[model samples]
Target: MSSDDNAAHMKETKEGLHSDHHVDILHAEVLASSDLMNDAFDGENHEHSQGLWQSVKSHPWACLWAFIMCFTIVMESFDMFLNGNFVALPAFQRRYGVETADGKWEIETKWQSSLFQAGQCGAFVGVFLAGPVTNRLGYRWTTILALVMMNATIFISFFANSLTLLVIGQAFEGVPWGFFIANAPAYASEIVPLALRGACTATLQMSWSIGSIIVAAATYGYNKRDDEWSWRVPLALQWIFPTPLMILIFIAPESPWWLLRRGKKAQALRSIERLGSNSNAEGTQQTLAMMERTVEIEKKLGGEPSLLDLFKGVDRRRTIITCLMYASQNFAGNLIANQATYFFEQAGMTSEFAFQLNLINSCLQFVANALSWPLTAWFGRRTIYLWGTATNITLLMILGICASIPQTNSTNYAQACLGVIISFVFAGTLGPISYTIIAETSSVRLRALSTGVGRAAYYVAEIPMIYLASWMLNPTGGNIAGKCGYVWGGTAVVCFVSAYFFLPELKHRSYREADILFNRKVPARKFKSTVIDVRENE
Candidate 1:
């Protein structure tokens, strides 16, 4: 046969295979060759070969914008820590105290549990709404609106005199907290260079630790007070970060990816130009082209963006993996870290020491998150996630055994210390890594929707987990104290198993490359070795 005839035959065969859900070996080889040819011929010449430092030097403004936007995650973390800390406060307890058998003041278990649960519920609402809001308003405005809502809710909580009002205020706060959580990582991923995307998105986890540190310090300082002002002061302090952010956010650029998805090509170009430093122009253009091509391919495959699209065909896997990844954050025994102060106190540590331990844990988490930049650069996301989950399971099991022992100040202290170590591991690994995975795994057109759904899964996981943690620890409920670790230890085992089987290594896969891999139905184990010509793979 002539070469031209062979080419025509292959082309005809490829078209037939495209309509099928499965790809045969011959079809796969042809598609792979086509992609290779495209890469060889495509005019886009910029390389993603730059290291993190080189990328930062090339796009300083863009990196800074990503860092600043990621800082919003701190507020969400701060709210969670603030509620955790306050529940242990004598002053806070007295303000909403109910009589106990000993005739002493104590916050009811229901109120204690509902405070954080309310926030999670609100977060669920925000995650549900984030897709529409971000799609319509773009990243910058969605963030600004979240800040505005957060500030309003904080002020409401600052003035509330009753538990119901306070819980309501916290729920309101969760709305924007959810919005920021859903959108900020997506925004950072879109604006930064591919080499720095993991590091930048990981900043959300770092900011979360920073916020926890701040709340711990603030709560530690004020928990000693005897007035309503003790709790109210911390509630009011929520204004500190967002007030500055709201004003400064106007100066930041909208996500170029979002703009392009909306068909605003000129504005998307301007956004990319503004975000990238002058030296990064070529890379910016390459990135823009990559994004454009990914969107075009997705549109051809799935038509317009819809929430339902997340569950269809290849995206179904994306959505499930992303959701499971986010769920790993909660299921990896974070409950131990989240309620550390309470657990420490229950185990017989003084309130002061418990708060101090919480503060110390936050500091360690901050350091761990900082260290994760290099670690993430060095290792794949799946490796870190599995390792972290395994470590957490071991630590939680040991802590549970220690708690099951007879109560001694020394044993309690040891439990508190162990909790600190768990915090460090969780923050360093699953917390930061999951955000990057969720962002990387989703289709470009459904990035916002996928992230929102993933975050909703996170909150959904939290709903049952939070209630269980509360029931186990609350004096009026299960009051399991150190033994609570057993429950989470079991959960961590499940998380580890899921990650081993499902989480693919997305180490440096470009957005389009990921889509191609998923479309090809590549096994998770093969992702590291399966090289696709991303140039025309989509």
Candidate 2:
């Protein structure tokens, strides 16, 4: 055929194939050099026909991976908040007298009371150890070790008698909670489709809210029972939820990136194939390229991140911003959720009403979490954060105002209920959104470390507030609501300043793209000026 005729025929042929078939030529080109498509299709240039979700399910191994991941996250969330709804158990025991000395409250010396705080102390240790351990041991082993430690700790905690042993057990249990905190986000990010990564990343946080609801319901059911099993029942039930899931985690596929880092290319290909990929070839290619970039950047950065990197470098602002965000999250005062029963009692609500309030908060949290999924996507991260902060600030102020007014027999309780509703709304939105940002903000090399730092800050801020401030807020004949409001108002100021100055707008940015945006040598407030992306370059 003539050269002109052949060229015309080829153009028509390409257009015809494009119209007749769903596959993009560019996608095929991107997959050409990769191992993911090998043997799964027919010819040298054949396209993989399965839909994204279809591919996800068809790969038994990938489905198992996502399931195991989701399960671990769900259980961790459940475990993390076990103490949230049961402050009343110890408080009730203290109020009603549980083996106390003359004129001195001895509940502080009990295993049950100590268990409440020990888990958080353990989490602090876990957070400190996670980065080094994960880097050295690999994600799978880190996860496995954490699960083993957590399960063992849970079982041992049930058998403890003295407050000391309970604290030891709870602290030891923090090891795994730390492991989950450090690794789950990285693990989930590596496993799921980039398109769905945000949703899946938020999955654990959603499950956390759900788990809180579950624990609240259980606490409500067992609140008044005098049996030793009443507390044991709730504690022991942790095994029922996590043990089988631990076994599943053991068998789930190792992180594809982790495997790739070890030069296990064949295994990595098999891993992603089973795990889902974006249907567009460009996105998959982009992911693979980003993974390559992660390794390159890690090498160039030289050695693990130093403490100064979190404080003085281009990355320093990110660290500060994450810390501030985390602090705000904890400072919003979750004590109300955990110790709501006590807070209510101090505020003149009865024990029965306190439990009912706890149940209501848990339910509202679940609904609010469901609402956040759409809201976060519809409004950018920045907008949701601002909205949540404003909402929380307004709620806290109103609660403070209400508390200052004095609740006499003639006062309406509806305003008090309104304050409780506001607390629930604040948690549902900012609580999860802050977590989502922490996991996504930094580069892969620094993600776990940053997460560890942020969690440490979160717990440090959290425990003290819950234990001390909440304690003070409940002072006899004090403005309990106003005190709580003042604490949250301080948090709101931090949230507003941090959002405006330090935090970047990261919506729709890829991991590598985020790395570039954050690595730029500019103040965080000026990040938009230095932000770089391929689209902008083009």
Candidate 3:
């Protein structure tokens, strides 16, 4: 048969797989593709090759949307770091005790640490509750709920008389925190077209760096203040930052994917039109066909797959690898570098030197992430993961050894600075790339459930991290640096093995294609070859 006939036959055969449950998959892809056509795919790219930088820079609205949605993610990062590090900032300053030179509250007390943990505890509950809520109520409501709750957390934090009250407020904040983190990227992914998805999603990471810098700046600015009010202002502003976002997103387009999943075809079409600029009708039609097929498949499969289903079949491997990947990423030790500036002081550096070290680390992460942008485009996903995981392992070992050394007041700050730089290098490549892997490799039938599970692992992973570090950092123990390094080094080893054995390259595969890959019945260790290797016949 001729190629045209072969193409038609393949299409026909694929169409047959669009049974009931398969419809959800088909619709989501179509909606995603349509959203991309309007928001991401460029028909013009077919005719002319555009330089990568030029292509990205020219897409202002896409960039703007990315920046906007990522702002909340960024705020969350800022809060996470600020909350994490606030414990280390001198309790006199962390609590509302001291006043600033300008007569503002500087910070005070050990209770603030608990208040910070309170936020995470709230986050745990919020994260758990967000899934069903989003499923029932939609991403918009979740976003709104989080924004309101975050604002309340900040405002209540200002008035919190005791740690108990602060925890209560953080609990409220955590609810939305969980909601926003869970749904924001999914919502953001739906808004952009496919070609731009990688770039846009990767850019969300930039927000974390931005948040780190902002919190650092805020903390630094308030450092001179002798009062409790200094840090509170910045913490309060976290909620304020998202009020506008909540308003804007509520008025913005709902996920066409979500609409299609809920069997709202007309609404889905209308949602796509609103997302596009009227030049996207052809793209819209293509997207609609893709979504319609996806919806049909889901319907045939008898509706949404249960959480248990995510653990069955090839999806089981995908689920396991995904968990490992996310777990590795979180455990890689950047959180310590990112938040524990005060620990540097305990590590033999002065407070000024410690802050400077953190400054260098954050800057390097920005630079590293920027460098990786083009590299990610030229390289495939699996290659990046392998290289990044390996590189990170090496850097982490170097950090572990450096941290194990005894530093004096006269120790070389420059060497310490080098450790900070390597930390960023690890984060720049490993940090963002791991998220990409987790998001890409999972089966669509289990994406949301898997994502939530991965995120929960992330938060839960913190318990051991905090416990070990706290024990090691005890003034009498002097093992903080050593223990921190050991934990990360171990994680690196796991990552290297996981990548070698289990990870499948997801480059260029559609969501449906991924499903086909999982169903191929290849052993987990051989996944990459059977599905993605695609070497010519021997």
Candidate 4:
């Protein structure tokens, strides 16, 4: 607040409690002892200007809680990883697929599409369910309920003798995964100081990469077996994540942001206290002031935090940008990249070699994700995402050109090399950074609903795209082979154009500052240079 505003707020506080002389005396004492404008009043402001490591060191407890919540993403990751990679397992194909004229067994492209899409569709429902449920029940209890729902649903897919049962089970299990996707990052973002927000939120993506890394190794180990256990072992592993996460969440602090939204100021304060409680009293109050002011402004601007508010007023731009930011992941070729193991096998590498290459790619993804924490801090979200997408275009163009020529060992190896590079760039840059962008873009009042709606858009885009990917990659389908890179390259161009126009640089901004920038309708290119009074709520 400006000097005038601060004086007015203090005046109003004193006048309201004027009849209570004791209150007035205590308020004066606080004013004399604590300066709201100084570093003591708000540690976040102090940390905001500090470097990344300083921020991390300041909020170690926040980081620990954030990690616990982010770890929930690992459950969703394992399910998704198994959903696609299982098709690449030779024994899995022998167990579930048909023998063709060439005497080779293969799972049909339609089934592959159906299995993954079932999970997508289920996640759509789960995200929608989570938004409202989370608002009422809070992030902690809602996660507990989702755990129960997920474990129960796993049984349906685990023992199924028919593909239909497995598909239904995958869809059912997806509902809980949707809940995890929508809330984990939001919870992480709320608990941390602003300096840690971007990297912490982006860690949701790292947990995902961690999940992929674990399952990749497991699938490679089991891929060589020609028995039912080859696939069943990985499916059984799904149970590992949720049970442990449920136990940890029982003792975790509720998101202060979520509590403040519910108008439980005391509880919000206590939750902040619980989350290592901000270092000092002045810092705690300052944190609450910033969080409270930001939430109140959003509520005023957006009104009552309904799902419809996501598309109204300034929120319209935010909601659309967030949703498309998510959809761009699929557009930039995630669905195609997701089937890399199958892509390699169809392109003529042995199944064992394909798994080996996939394992290497998964490991590289972890390294990229680890670097993204600092890179996100240094380069900013919009810059890195654009760089990642632009690089993918060049790589995909070359891959498409290579695919156009007659098949050769050299061309196959070239396509494999290009595919690994695309995933690596995505993991480090766009993939994880997108998590940061989504959290930053959504208005705090409408954050949970916005995340759900945006993630739901991701699931929706994947539906048709999954079918196209299956047809293009499957031998019995379109057989577009490595030339599929052209399709994703074309879409990456769309991602670049949309990002250039729509995505803004939200780096190093507090939630209040971000809201002010969007409210002013600043141009995307001008975001970094824009200045505001910030003292006035308007």
Candidate 5:
């Protein structure tokens, strides 16, 4: 075919795959050009030989872009932590809390639930909205838009007069949180080479912990002030992440996969060049062909490549695994760990000491998140996830057992210490690795939609759990305090059991290998032993 004819034909194939999801394996241009197909397969093998260090060296710009995008997660985490910790601030209580029969000011169980879950509710909306918006504007503009929207939403939060206003502000703030949560890891997964994929995507969780740590320290520092500034300062700080991040995202390269789908192959090649810091012209074309090949495989697997496709064919299993990976995090006791400051005070510690312990707890969480990277590398995703959940279950049962003893400072301290430890354990395991699973499992065409759906499941499960948590922790409510560990422990048992039986190990597999395994319907337990046939002769 002439060059012009070939360009037109390639565009037609991409449009078929993207618009209709009906590209035929035999007729598609991927097979039409045997040399292109062979080069694409060769690129996949070269990518496999490259380790994490080499991948980083090969794609430094990709790593940097992923870092900046993940850094935007700091905004979400800071706001999320601030929402859960609000009641821990005496000044915040004075501003929003009601006077109690015992002469202490406290936020209501109902109001507390509303405040704490408000961001999540908005996040749920944001996750769904991102799909259509990203389809229209692509990932880069969607991120920039979300960051700008955050400034408008946080304004409502910083100047709120009533508890009702505060809830509304937080809900609005959550829309951007949802945007980042659903899209950042998806972006990271698409832009990086296979060797850098896990680390790049898992960086989302590390950024989350960094945000939590900063908020914890800030809330602790500002808690002593009796003025409204105590709460206002934290709310105001939300602006810092978006403005700089918005500017950075404005200049970042768009996801080449999205670019390719839109049939902007030239732009896609340029993007790969921008992302591939060390690749020569030939290397960049190989990467592009490799991406094109993966998209073609997905095209053959499912037509339409929409959210509904997430529940059909091989994708159904993938969607289930992705959703469970995320939902398990909530059910497996991090809820209590997240609300450590409130849980500590409810367990009978003084407010000042609770704040101190909360700071320390968040710091430990940051350290744990960092430690999980090496663990993910050595033990694989499934091992760390199952073992972490197992360890959390054991610790939670012991914590519940401790909560049962007559309420003493030693017992309360023990409970506080255990909450800290549980947070550390969870941060090290499920927290970061969940992103890796989401990145690896979903079909390439449906990655953003799948990520949004999976994370939406998290918000869905968490909404009811938040109400339950507020009821359990509120003095006017159940006031079960640390004993909630028993409740979460039961849920952790469910996570551990389900994970052992269902979650697959995708440790060193390239995206194509993952697709082949999932398409062949390999059992989760046998994933590690399944050998893929990579020969192009077929």
Candidate 6:
């Protein structure tokens, strides 16, 4: 045959094979969907048709496991909020402060800020370390190891006589902080049914607020004490949450997705059985097939999972969105809100009242976080993020205006009060919801690594903002007062814009569905409405 004729024939043959493959994939999808629907509608076990409450009722054990697992974040919350509370304590200041000419004692502003950021710096290290560790050890063991290390570091801080030692202890405590933050949401997302994913994943934020509230109350109870014991007592209390977490974590099942990736198909199926409400074997089998097929598709698209793979192709966009989502938590005035105790005290509220106010703010935040579960389940991540960002920006700008006014004692109190309320809104809405977005955005194979990298961005973003917060609010620093709000207000504007443009809604999307959507490069706005056939698309 002529060379041209042979080439044309070969091209036609390739097209015919491609067309046949497409037809076969579509045929398979139709068959799988038919089976899935039949299983979902089967007699008494129609989990797919059930609401969240019904699902919970049907799978009480699985729901309980998810709840217990989320409680681990309370320890993370305590560690995160402890520095903010302690930095505002007069007794803590007196213990660490240098005596001045007027017989007053003051902790150095640089140390005050750096001590808080020091833990975050350690968190940065832990965040990177958590990815590989979780990949190898799975979530349960990684968490146990992290909890042990966290307890050890907290004890070191509780005994330390020097600020340097205390800072080191805080830094080490952060290592576990990184581990928990990286793994907790990933774990929750994996174990919970898709119907409950929003509410369940949001427990990460809710638990953090619960932890913050406990510490705030602890600090309030100790604030009036005139010795080192005041701070020491609260620091010691860090051990409370982890003891139960370590015990409970042992009983929790490994993520089925993780097991499936590691080729433990039987264990993976058993995990699905334990965690899923779908009572029929057919339903579980369908889910397992979806998972396996999705993983296969991901393998084709991205080779094998690695740290470097997070930054390639569609994953690069996912990484950026995830990182920015985490960064948005801090940038959306989280640092300023976190330092509410210090800011209130600086504005002339008595130390006890400041702590009391902080306690109230924590309560408000806890309520807000609880509210977020329903809100997130109803509205999804992007809407909450955009709305929350706008709310925080307006509140911060108003606070800046209030702070910029000439200081009247009443106005100072007013600014502090307003700032606390604004912070509560931000915490309930943006702060915890960001974790959900990160968890949902990542590919299953790279979830730990993506979440770790995203969380590491959170700490990295906090570095400058922490110092800036110290300067703006500290008496010895720029003491920008409410003007710090202006800076964070501007940041919130940036966050709002980025989230509106880049953050896609993944409210009801399964991991495989999310993969297909990202693979197709769907516009952010279209995610909610776009229908994808995961089996056929591959």
The model with the greatest TM-score is 5
Off by over 4 Å in 4: 1-44
Give the alpha carbon lDDT tens digit for every residue of 398-494 in model 6. Answer: 8888888888987888888887878788878897788788889999889999999998888888888888888888767786877888998999999
Model 3 CA deviation exceeding 4 Å by range: 1-63, 91-116, 276-278, 405-415, 474-478, 522-538
Candidate 2 local lDDT, 241-295, one digit each (tens): 5567667776677776666555444455445544543334333333444454454
lDDT of each: 0.81, 0.60, 0.60, 0.81, 0.83, 0.79
Itemize residue pairs with steric clashes in candidate 6. none
Best prediction by lDDT: 5
lDDT of 5 by residue, 194-253 (tens): 877778888888887888888888889998999988888888878778888888999999
Candidate 2 whole-model C-alpha lDDT, 0 to 1: 0.60
lDDT of 4 by residue, 1-538 (tens): 6788867875564344323232212212232323432322354455467778887777788898898888888887887778778888888788889887889888998898988899889999999998999999999999889998989999998897878889999999999989998998788888887778888988887887888887889999999887888888889888887788889999998998888777665566667766763466545656655666666666656545678888788889999998998899987756655787888887778888988888888888889889999897789889999998999888888889989999899988988888888888888888888989998888788888998999999988888999898898887898888898899999999999999988999988778788889999999889989975445455
* 1 or 6, greater by lDDT: 1
- Report lDDT (Cα) of residue 320, candidate 5: 94
Shift of residue 156 alpha carbon in model 1, Å: 1.9
Worst 10 residues of 1 by lDDT: 22-31
Question: How far does residue 88 in candidate 6 sit from its true spot (Å)?
Answer: 1.7
Task: Give the Å error, residue 191, model 4.
Answer: 1.2
Worst 10 residues of 5 by lDDT: 18-27
**How would you encode candidate 1's per-residue C-alpha lDDT over 1-538 as one tens digit per residue?**
7778867875664344333343233212323344323432241234356678887887788889998998988888888988888889988877787766767566777887798899989999999899988998998899999998887788778888788998988898899988898898899898887788899999999998889889988999988999988888887788898889987788998887788777765567677778767745334444555556666667678756889999988899999998998887887778777877887888778888888888888899999999889888889989999898999999999989998988787888888888888889988998899888888899888988989999999888887888888788877788788888888899999999988988899887877678789999999989999977644545
- Residue 460 alpha-carbon offset, candidate 5, angstroms: 0.8
Order the candidates by TM-score, highest first — what do you get? 5, 4, 1, 6, 3, 2
User: What is the TM-score of each predicted model, taking all chains together?
Assistant: 0.90, 0.79, 0.80, 0.92, 0.93, 0.89
